[model samples]
Target: MQNLTQAIKHLIIINVIMFVAPMLLNMDLTNLFALHFPKNQHFGIWQYVTHMFMHGGFYHILFNMYALWAFGSPLEHMWGRNKFLFFYFSAGIGAGVIYTLVNYYQFNGIYDQLINLGVSAADIQNVLDTGSYNESIITLPNETMREFYSLYHTPAVGASGAIYGILVAFAMQFPNAKLALIFFPVPIAAKYFIPIMIAADLFFGVTKYSVGNIAHFAHIGGAVIGFLIAWYWRKNQFTFR
Candidate 1:
């Protein structure tokens, strides 16, 4: 196991404190720190960065912190603290923006459909605010309406997006490195393993077949942003260390 690099060590500490402090204080910081929809009342600009440090549960934080230490440490070591920190925050902020844009696309699609069906702006806002809509007045599918409501109400919290960025950077740095998943113990090269993971997120994001309250687009966004920046750096032979 590699020793935790400076940036990764500090990041893990901050994430742990964010995760634990709320519980200890019996404080619900979700509204303040978690990433909410742009139209949501609790939405804040800072959430783009803060949400990366907030996690949903024990396993959520565990996996994210472990991945940060495992994948990010090497990147930090190679790029130095300043460059790695910049890339990390850039990818994370990019993830949040992409996630929001995708949600807005879906939400607006449904919203336009409702408007075409004679739903008024007031009624739509009411529905978003209260999660209540008169069935007789709106003939949209239950699943579609449910998704619309959820898009507005659900808040995203986790470092998975940023961790995904690190994973992409790691794979680019060491394509031939062996990697394995807890479920699939067979070791696979990072090049193959990383793409498969990103593909899985894309599939789940598009199909909405994900089992949990996962922000798959955020993962894909992080990977996409990470790839772009990493590719640019490599193409230019950029090195900070």
Candidate 2:
């Protein structure tokens, strides 16, 4: 590995810039980088790719970059720069598409439910188009109305899905590689870690559906796309070498 330097520098820099600059300036980089409605009044269409580069907080970016550097560099070396870049971007874009699917279900569901409860189409349109839920438009009982309003109001942002893709890649490629938890130092292979994490995401996603501000579905979406792409490569026996 003498000539093979860490190939994740650019990924690290992008994450750092996205995470640090925004927090330092007290700006919401997630909104700018996050993919919004096609006619999103908040951000441009370019945000689909830009959002993959942005992260929510220090821990968010740090863990992702760490995983990218840890597992992605090995894959890049095996796949070459061009191929690796292709996979990285493909996984990220795939994540965005899946997230959009989930958001569609959520936004439309909320809109329909609100309209049924006497909310106006104008207010529903605002939420669908801008990710905002108008409190004044809610006509249901107070507790249910408050809960409904909270569900569609906040923005979902991060690179965790794409990062989770990398984790999947790592698990598949090096199923035998032993990974140890720092705090709870049980040695488990990469293969075991990926599935366990996916299961936990699913459980939490279903069980805590009402809890505000978590994009558990997005995590599942990313993993599914990553698995499909990786499986195709493996099935075709296509090696970058």
Candidate 3:
């Protein structure tokens, strides 16, 4: 592995601190830092950037920080600290925005269905706030209703989105680099591996087949933004340092 560049080192440090400090201080920063649904009372504008530093669990931070060190270090070395930081934050924020938009589409779809079923706007809002509804009144499938409830109540945390951006950038820079995953132990070139990863995210995102509380759309958003920026920079022969 390459030595950690200045930006990657500091980012990992900050993420570790954000993850550890709350536990040490006996504080819950999720309401303040994690990205919440726009209509959620806990939602804040600053969460788009802060959520990149907040993590949900030990393995989450471990994988993200490791990816930052492994993939982001090389990009930082190539692009210099300032450029790398810009790309990282841009992709992170873009991921948050895209994630929110997708959620809005899903949320509104269910909301409209309820309204068309003669449910009032206030009652719908009440369902979101209280997580209780007149099951007799809400005839939508239980799974769809549960998804709507989850989308409104759950907040997104972790650096996975930004790490995905770094992964895309790294692949573009080192297309022939061999990469492998734990489950799929066979090594494959970055050019082939990264797209497959993004495709998996997209498939799971659209099909709702993902296990756990994974934000698959956020991964896709990061990959899209990363590819656009990296492609533009390469095409225009742009260099920051």
Give the best candidate by lDDT: 1
Query: What would you estimate as the lDDT of candidate 3?
Result: 0.92
lDDT of each: 0.93, 0.70, 0.92
Question: What does candidate 2's lDDT look like per residue over 32-70, in tens digits?
Answer: 667665434565667767877876667777777777877
- TM-scores across all candidates? 0.98, 0.81, 0.98
Superposition TM-score, candidate 1 onto the true structure: 0.98
- Tell me the tens digit of each residue's lDDT in model 3 across 170-213: 99999999999999899999999999999999999999899999
- Model 2 TM-score? 0.81
Write the residue-wise lDDT of candidate 1 on 1-241 in tens digits: 8888888889999999999999999999999999999999999999999999999999999999988888898889889998899899989999999999999999999999999999999999999888888899999999999999999999999988788888999999999999998899999999999999999999999988999999999999999999999999989988775
| Model 1 residue 172 lDDT score | 97
All candidates: CA RMSD (Å): 0.9, 3.6, 0.8
Candidate order by lDDT, decreasing, is 1, 3, 2
Query: For model 3, how big is the CA root-mean-square deviation?
Result: 0.8
Model 1 spans > 4 angstroms off: none
